[model samples]
Target: MQKYSERKNSAIDKTANPESGNVQPKPRRRRTAVNRGLDENGNGKRKPRRQARRSRSGGFKNTFLLTGIEILGLSVAAVCAVIMLLGYSAGRFSGTSFFGHLLPFTAGVLVLIVAAALFLLGWWKLRQWLRRYSEFLTPALSLSLALLTPWLVTHDQFTLAYGNFRTLVGGKEEAGRMTISHQVYAAYRRHDAAQLQKMVNRAQEYRQAIEDAARSFAVDAHLLHGIAATESSFIPRDSHDGGRGLFQITRVPETVIAQARKRLNVEKISLDDPRHNAFVAAATFKHYLAEMKDDLFLGLLAYNIGPANGGLRFIMQQYGATDFTTIQPYLQTLPRDYPIRVLAYSLAFRLWQQEGRLLAYEEGNNAIRIQRIGIPGLRAGL
Candidate 1:
């Protein structure tokens, strides 16, 4: 009994001594309401609440700063894109300029790069928008906007409408002067890029003669040059319609030819000679211009379709019209496109003579040979 009691006391001692290495761990102290801003009543405590409010305020400030920075970046990009696009569309830096070639070339290339970057960014944004929206709505809205873009830009802002995909890539310039040649416009309508190319290329060969004739008649050399281009593309030929030579003299009375010869002080004149042809064409144009009371459109029309289609006077009298626009509707019945064609060619030649190229964008492209001043020895004969 004594031994049994001693053993039990030893076991008790061992249990109480944690150094024996067989002790149970103490209970963990649970965090109370005050530690996490909660009170005994379960309401949020003031100290922790203030700290949380401060944290939220800091987060909001950071977010606002980030948003502002994003907006600023986007605004700068937009401004740059617009400037570049404007420069590109207005042809401010292609071919040649009054400001200087190097300036335009450098500026054009830089603007093109910026415009390209902006276009790429916009394309990416468009893709993102498409992804963010429903499939049906995205395509439908995008298509509608795309279709409307050209129409709105062309009609409202003429100069800024020089995008590659626009209806009028070159813009509606020289509208009033477009009626100077019929054959040129016909070629344009037919999309005869080859013949059109020839017109400019051959201009250099007969340029001197055209200039002299125009000077004699007190006419814009480019205008007369345009007429020759339209009539024959500077190639001497006879048409089945009875048109002949560089000017394609068709129905001029013998008396008028004799009078022209006398006025030019040339005893023997042949339509085959470019110089003579240019003189005759200029004289004819002058006579018709006076006959139609100096109405350029009417004069040009009479030269193209002949005065016999009731003449410009009879047509104007019949329609009670005074201006081209007023008479335009009736003109469709005749060779109205003739004048427009002449004008287009004339305008192109004028641009070439002034800027050393056909268009502001014609440089570096294979569209037309802008630098073809004629064959090296071709000018010798003239």
Candidate 2:
């Protein structure tokens, strides 16, 4: 029995120790401290902790993505803001090519679109606090800026822009109907104020001749002055395709000259004489005025292009039009814009006479400030 017990014990030890060259099943590994914490139901209490760690990592990634997006949206909005500000300056909108005129409007619309898009993006990507403010702030600011744009642009001495803005508001139709002279005056005022001032001063030298011509032919002295200024820049011997002398008089047939001289009751007329030139110009304007039945627009046009193609009768019979607006389109090769230039110079002369000093058309601080007054049917006329 003792021998049998020893053999059985040896067999058990061999089974326990596989290295003894006996075939035996391998022992299972002992559970680590972490695994030992699991409950008996096969569900680990620590599983929720692992899940929480994964959720935290994913949340951090989402936050970083949103931050990048918000930065991108804000950057675009900043660029749009700069564009809007430039558009509101109103410098690029006048007397330019069609593309130039369109630039401000197009830029404004584009900026508005970008601002709106940013506002929408902010709704999703911005932080909670930032998003709350961005929702209404973006659109409100954009709309307010747009509404103020025209007023801000009109505050400058940009004459064309001022007129355009006035027209837009629909209170002053006359401002929109700027004569050719107004455009030229604005150009000279902006680019060559000194030159304009010099011309006005030199006009005084011919004041006596202009006065004599006005009295002889019953023309306005300011009209003669403005015509001379517009035609020759107050230079007595200025010559052009129109002819020679201070008035830029076109040479007529000897018979026509004699007839004009008879009508004016003047003798010994010379084109070179400043007084004679002024007298002839006044007489010619008067003749055209009479020929056109006192139609001012046609008379002015005929003085430049002659009665054959101009004047009230010819324009009415040929083009079936009676008003200046209708005849303007048919004018060409006769300095159609000359009257506008002359008229504009006339206005400047009047202003100078009134103020005793020319006002510098400063860009930001201009003299033409049209008060906003609501007029019924003003916008409809446009």
Candidate 3:
């Protein structure tokens, strides 16, 4: 009994010793260049990596900055697009202006910049978030890309409208709308005895019928020159658009052609000859002018657009009041400025007589603003 109790007490003493489960393990020392070796598992290896690079406090600040810049640029792009569209609506369709043409180009560039910046920002935010949160990045990137489509489409429409506006503004300039011929007007302006003799000689040879027609119509000889210049450019032998001959008369209906054949004693009236066409046109206008002496402008306008559709009356009502100064603003879209152009021809004739040359542009000589210029006693404001 005494041996058994002594053994049990010795076992309890061994179990209660301080070194049983609390033994002091060796401290781990960092590797040095001279003694670095493989890890104990099998082969040497690197330590496990730490958390992601943007794991700390500063990461959110950068994201907010990127988002703000992106939104600001996008807002600027949208505003520029609106302004350009307004210019187009106001009849400033010609993109020849620096601001006009660049409107659309600017919009496109802005959109691209905004999209790229926003995409980069979203991507960066997503990458950071994905390290800790997978669900948010997928839908966020999808929505951003989808939203970019409308911006790109609007940019294209703005560009197209700008281009159309340029063409609508008459080749983009005044010069294009009414190009001038310099050489012919120059030949007309000689004012010397010898020069007169030379003009006489040329007139007799190249232009006898013109003088005869002018005499009969009581029209200024220079008016004939203006007509010829505008009608055929003095080429005499070309025709277009129901226009037959130098004066571009569309009055070659079957009855008129038959009468022309009988009167001129030609089997058929050919549009290629200047003399026949010029005489006929002068005769027609002379008759019309005599009948409508009260309103020369209306008569001329009637002859050009014709009395067919009240187009002339509509024009008169639309453009008559303020004179011709602001008439261009009312035109929707016409291939030519009909009134201004015919007046240009009239001025050409006046200048042809006064200066004896074809000037590029001549002041309208009270012709364009006929009612405005006046004699002192007869017309202070009449």
Candidate 4:
């Protein structure tokens, strides 16, 4: 009985040590990764400690926040710009189909809403919180949008659009710039359908001449229109400021006029008749633009404010600056938006051409021309 009882106790002990066959010592409990932490109410209970909150990378934190804010702002601005562009686009294509009215109206309303949202965000919740966002995101967003530009430009509509975009002075030239500039288009321009239509029609009259000039200067037609509009309202009338016709070209000093007449074997040009006046004006503007090596704005300033020789000296002195963007504050009221107005007209002309408002003359084709000759050259052979 004693031997049996001893054997039973030993058997029970052997069963309890299930892994005794293995030679390794009993494994240790894996130390919990988290140290013991206080419970929710600060009581001692089984709780996990966090991993020290990633050590608070202050610089990274600030940068991330700033990036987020900048993205938000740029997104808003981009939407606003697209909306405003749609507005102008609406008024531009107003007489078309049902989609036309719907497009512009929706665009106009959306532009206002986007602009208002940006304004509110800037004024209310994100004034300072997102200040760094603009700084950080502007360049990055510009780069991202710029990547799409080449692709956008390659499309037929956007190719024509890119050609037209090259003509606007202060407006957005690409998608990135559009993000910020859409706000300006919305706030400043009213998109008057009638005025735009008239301006478009007026631009048609001199389309050939401007196109010719553009080819000559390797310049944009819309820019030429802007200059012409400011200089003479495309009326080809004389300037009250001793300037000539379409581009408001001024007479050479009487002495210079005499010399030019002798040199070119020409007579004094009349400044009253619109056509002749436009001829002289465009030629003279071409000369000035040439002299400036196509610094169009300076040439224009010379046209309006009178440049000494090529208008460089006065431009530097009066505007108190060298950059074009900085010129606005230094200018007198005689010509406001001096650059932008001309740029607008130039852009308008480009739009007309893209939209087929201008007849293609194919360089020298006479299918659409009415040339005057002593012997009726147009009917001579036929």
Residue 377 of candidate 1: its Cα lDDT?
A: 12
Write the residue-wise lDDT of candidate 4 on 1-382 in tens digits: 9999999887767666766552445578774424345454556655224433443566678777766765665565555345335534543554536676666666666767787778657644544544455645443553465456445434344333332333232244333333323332332244454666676777677777666645544544556676776666666655577676666666444443343344334576555544444444445555555655565555555455554443544656655775444565666564635644565444445445554543232335321121110011011110
Question: What lDDT tens digits, residue by residue, belong to model 3 across residues 345-377?
Answer: 444444444546533323344222221221111
Clash totals for all candidate models: 8, 2, 10, 5
The sequence of per-residue lDDT tens digits that candidate 1 reaches over residues 52-103 is 8999999898656654554554455544445436545445444446567557
lDDT (C-alpha, whole model) for all candidates? 0.62, 0.61, 0.48, 0.50
Q: Give the range of the ten consecutive residues with the poorest summed lDDT in model 4.
A: 373-382
RMSD of 3: 24.5
Candidate 4 residue pairs that clash: 222-346, 223-346, 226-342, 244-249, 307-311
Best by lDDT: 1
Stretches off by above 4 angstroms in model 4 are: 1-189, 213-219, 238-244, 251-266, 273-275, 287-293, 308-312, 315-320, 334-336, 357-382
Residue 73, model 3: Cα distance from true site in angstroms: 81
| Position 330, candidate 4: lDDT | 60
lDDT order, best first, reads 1, 2, 4, 3
TM-score of every candidate: 0.45, 0.45, 0.33, 0.40
Q: Write the per-residue lDDT of candidate 2 for residues 269-326, one digit (tens) a residue.
A: 7878887788788887777777777755566666767545434467667877665567
